[model samples]
Target: MPLKLQSTFPALSLFGVLATLLSLPGLFGCQFPPKIDHGRYTKLFSIFSTEYKYECDSGYTLVGEEKISCSDSVWSPAAPQCKALCRTPEIANGKLSVYKIHYIEPETVTVQCNTGYGVVGSERITCLENRTWYPEVPKCERKILAGCEQVLAGKHLMQCLPGSQDVKLALEVYKLSLEIDVLELERNKEKAFQEP
Candidate 1:
């Protein structure tokens, strides 16, 4: 009978290296390395040779290579920056639901237009992996009201305006009150005639 030797050794491939580093994850650093804003380099992992790497923080991604080389105490190709996946853009006459200053990759946000305004584009946008927001932010446009000003402010108008419901509601209440007064007057008149 021939004895077989099973290889229990783990692979040191890119994923294996990363997985090993992930086990001890918290923060990373490199000796005498270039400073990258919103970014950090992973621990030195050895295969054929030891190396330094880079990764970005939450809501940011590297713009250049993740692996950097140090020669003669100088970093080659420069250190990549951790760019924001998406910046909270200002929506004129509208508002975004996200309260964060910046958003991470794959995050989506919903936009809402103020009263008396209509949206001109998609109401939602997603943060793409390419460090950009998919589909530009939507714009809010004030609807044209041909006779909005002409309509009395005390009643419902054809043009959609803020507080229009309140105005129409008040008008309805006023009409009902007048109707009650007329009915009461008529009842009094009939009673007076009968008394005479």
Candidate 2:
């Protein structure tokens, strides 16, 4: 009876291929995940690479792709940045002249209405630090200038107050202002005396 020895070349060859493929990444200098300021990413595993889904914190806006791929242990493209900005404002029947995913704080946007519609509120709105829009969102009110419906319906588009009423209201306002001024003067005098 003759004993035969089996060569492990086939198994060893497969192992060598895997080892070289895995070591190639290290040889080329594998990269760690890049740190994204004001943002975070979640790791997703893949067969030959890694993926990350990024998200900006509250009050921060992401400026790049939400998902990024890392092939051969190096991230593709550049990491996204999180910017402190206000979310886009939604205005019914109107649109902003310059639309963006987010707006810088204190920035102003122009509002435009569709055809046959008229702007009913501020034509321009400013973004605030608190992410709220100043002067509120505008609306596109259907134009009624072709007819007298708005005026007849007393929509207040045209003023029709009597002269007597206007004078009376003005006098009342003047009296209130005078009283306030007197009170303020008296308070200032008292404060001066106390300071001395």
Candidate 3:
């Protein structure tokens, strides 16, 4: 009986060691998927039925599945791809002054209003990671000169002078009204600049 017990003890130890070795791979989460370029996994070691979150690089948007799971020794939903997109935004009543024609991610462009117009929003816009412009596109609006219409209307109330003098006086009034309008426009612009 003592001899039989000694023989069974060694066999039981060997069986226990074999069982631990066989289960180590699954227990320690050693199985991992392949490395992805421009992407990252949620965990270093991917275990069976483990779901991993993937992220793409800046300026590149994810085109396929965002999360993938490891099942049956294979990555489900396959691998996602990072796609590059260059989108140019349209500015209303203005045009974009870009260094390059193609507007890729992180690219910046200046918005300039047309003549006789002023910008109401941001002067510059940046391309975001999602292939869209940040802060949206700015718009240009027509600038109104303060008291310009009133000055023009006051011209009709003035007394009429004689012959050529009347024509000269009218021209002079028109010129003075134009100057006033220009000065008022400048003052308004300066006020806008000082505020904010």
Candidate 4:
């Protein structure tokens, strides 16, 4: 009996075998695993304290944390949340612009009045590590002017009345005359001490 010989696998035959093996999955009666829909799995995954990233809806903002990671295929207890952050207070007239932190934690803003007004506390106070304002709430009050009695001998005299103005003017004139007399006396003494 003559022995039948088998053909050796060549370059073309190797390629054909590979193609058949790869196509066999789709050709034969085989089924792939069901794909997981992210939306449907979202609620199921939320039960676990797994770190996740969630997008906020329009018109709504996200605060606190935005992203987190899961370890051991489980979310951490410190899950990131989306909260509303406090907005910066409206700046009043003659007030400086304080930093408005929408993403960060709440902060306090202190306003300082112009030079004419007296600032009750710090001009610009902000929240410290404790989330509390340094100076709390500050106020601005108008500076008080000195009264007539508080004025010095010839300082800041208002000309409210003509009679009072005349008296103030006379006092000023007498003070000027006294200064002139003193200067004259000093000159006379200096001349007397000078050599001939």
Candidate 5:
């Protein structure tokens, strides 16, 4: 009876050791949590009641819960989703050269004002990671041309004008000639005053 009791005792000890080793993982929370797409987690173990924080990658925004806690070997509140978005920019008196009507993050667009309007900001804008444009939206303002500048611009336009299209060119030339005549009269008046 003593020999049988010794053998049974050794067997019981071995079984106890095996059970403890098997349960060690549960005690230390050794299970790995599920991966979150487009995001990363901070905690190594997903033990019960352990919280894990998640962050989205560049050009992606987190949606739903930012942190999830493990419960019953499963993450609660589910993993947050990373969504990409790009807000469309608004520009007054200007137009954007975008390939897609719906904008996306990290995309580039060219901004230009209409004819006779001046741009007050950057001509190119890039979508940022936060779904906002890097530079502020450009503004287009009506160009106020000086009298001489208008005449000069008109002369340049005339150079490009076809010979057959004379109506518009002739009108601009007539206006310039009238301006020249008025300047000559003013000069003559100044000359008369100097002589006296």
Candidate 6:
């Protein structure tokens, strides 16, 4: 009887352990992981509390809030509005050229030329949604007519003589005087030659 009781005891213990395990919900029925509530900003697993943020695409400007929130499982305040970026005047050879511009939108690249240089074509440009800008870059050129006044100043006296004195009469008088001097020298030379 003792030997039989010992064998039966082992079997009974095994049966009890199996019965306890089988009775659990995981064993008897399908057990699932806990479900998260998406209601009223509740439990957004991958996101943070209330606020969500998004960045605008290149060449686009954000017109509304950069951040949005979730409430009752729905996005709050809607997605931010986007607009096409405005342009700004461009500059070329900034070291030598000059330009002026106003930026109409954000993220627009503005360039300018240095002073004493002028630009050609449209100076203002903008980056578009297509990732491009219009009007391209302008060229820079040096300013013309640097020392014209100095040249004029040098010729001022020459011009004043024409107005003050009769040019034709003065020229004739000067020629006659030269002729007289030449005749005198020739006469002297002839007299010397004849005497010798």
Model 4, TM vs. native = 0.33
TM-score against native, each model: 0.38, 0.36, 0.36, 0.33, 0.39, 0.32
Per-residue lDDT of 17-78 in model 4, one digit per residue for the tens? Answer: 76655433233333321122111112213322332454544323444344444444333333
How much does candidate 5 score in TM-score? 0.39
Clashes of each: 0, 0, 0, 3, 0, 5
Q: Where does candidate 3 have its weakest 10-residue lDDT segment?
A: 41-50
For candidate 2, write residues 1-196 as lDDT tens digits.
2333235666778877866564443443556557787789876644345567789888877777787765655767678877668778777777899999889767899999988789888999998756788888888888876545634454341244467677567557756866897999999999999995
Model 3 root-mean-square deviation: 15.3
Instruction: Please list all clashing residue pairs in model 4, or write none if there are none.
Output: 49-75, 50-75, 51-75
Ranking under lDDT, best-scoring first?
Answer: 2, 5, 1, 3, 6, 4
For candidate 3, the lDDT comes to 0.69
The runs of at least 3 residues in candidate 6 whose Cα sits more than 4 Å from the true structure, single-residue gaps closed, are 1-53, 56-63, 70-75, 81-92, 95-112, 146-196
Indicate the TM-score of model 3: 0.36
Q: List model 5 lDDT by residue over 127-174, tens digit each.
A: 765667778878888887776665676667777767856857677677
Is candidate 4 or 6 superior in TM-score?
Answer: 4
Give each prediction's root-mean-square deviation over alpha carbons.
15.2, 14.5, 15.3, 18.0, 11.3, 21.6
Error of 2 at 118 (Å): 1.2
lDDT of 3 by residue, 1-196 (tens): 6999999999999988866554443443436544566667564343233566777776566667878665555677887776545566666677888645457556778899998799887888887656777777788997768856665454554445557777677778878977997999999999999999
User: Model 1: which ten-residue window has the lowest total lDDT?
Assistant: 1-10
Error of 5 at 50 (Å): 23
**Regions more than 4 Å wrong, model 5:** 1-83, 148-185, 188-196
